[model samples]
Target: MKIDMSNLKFGAVEKPEKIGNEYFAVVPYFFTLKCNVSSMNDDMKKKIGAAVIQKYGKNNVQYLAAEGAYLINARMRACAISPDRKTWKFVILEKEYKSQLVKVLPKKILDKI
Candidate 1:
């Protein structure tokens, strides 16, 4: 099933937190994409990473090989994992600090993933 990110709403903001002299607002938004695949491997990672780079630009996307994840930006990430041997799960989360919220994921990106 395809998700329409524009229709998805943000959850309630948490209580503000103070660090030193700065106060920050924590707003979290997340979504999951499920795929039926035989396995989650390096080739799959590259394909997903390429889609992210194409959408967000190469300079904005960082791949963490050790974590098997892509940090899409300072506030967002798309991580792939296998719950068993046949299911592939992409957990895309945008948890922004200081109220700089990321409210949508592009349909093109979703289709690519």
Candidate 2:
């Protein structure tokens, strides 16, 4: 089933900034579920990253992290999915916060990936 996006509302995008050698941008989150940032296990982190990719796409998804480690996935970067905490903050030097365009993607869009 597809979600009704007629009333979609996108959250605000934060100003981009440079940290060390990377540029990062924050956007108002679009997800409905989030695990505690400081309490996730490796499996939980992967699942969270996957949930984001399913809604945003692989190219749009970036860093995946738990409390212990951070994993970077680049097919050469961008994806978002859930709760107010379910947002991506990655090496924005070559990435874009596509969440400014829409709240959620449809099944057909997810299938093409």
Candidate 3:
């Protein structure tokens, strides 16, 4: 699975700086990611998460714990399917403490925006 986090909001921690003797400085920071999900398959998702864990270290990816584990399909765009297909919930991130809920907009809407 190709997981692209190109549009997701996220936080990041800075590397620790070593000082002389036994002192060190550590800084924690947060940043939003333009994340994307790709090549979504169940097993592939697991591998992608594992890869993220490896790259960002376990602590960094811990935020995902609240959201649960899911796979990212890089090639797949979040588009609405026919009624016969299962409909999924849609959400838009808000800068405020709370998120804004919205129904899935039609593909045409995306094109306009």
lDDT of each: 0.44, 0.40, 0.35
lDDT of 2: 0.40
lDDT of each residue in 64-109, candidate 2, tens digit only:
2333333323232222332233455332212243343333433322
TM-score of each: 0.32, 0.27, 0.28
Q: Clashing residue pairs in candidate 1, if any?
A: none
* Backbone clashes under 3 angstroms, per model: 0, 9, 18
* Residue-level lDDT tens digits of model 3 in 3-96: 3354443234223222222212222223333223343555665676787666455655532433444333222112222332234222222223
Considering TM-score, where higher is better, how would the candidates rank from best to worst? 1, 3, 2
Error of 3 at 37 (Å): 3.4
Candidate 1 clashes: the total is: 0
lDDT of 2 at 85: 38
Please report how far candidate 3 places residue 1 from its true position, in Å. Answer: 7.4
- Evaluate residue 2 in candidate 1 and report its C-alpha lDDT on the 0 to 100 scale: 21
For the record, the alpha-carbon RMSD of candidate 2 to the native fold, in angstroms, is 16.1
Ten-residue segment with the worst summed lDDT in candidate 3?
Answer: 18-27
Q: List runs of model 2 lying over 4 Å from the truth.
A: 1-38, 64-113
TM-score, candidate number 2: 0.27
Q: Highest lDDT among the candidates is held by which one? A: 1
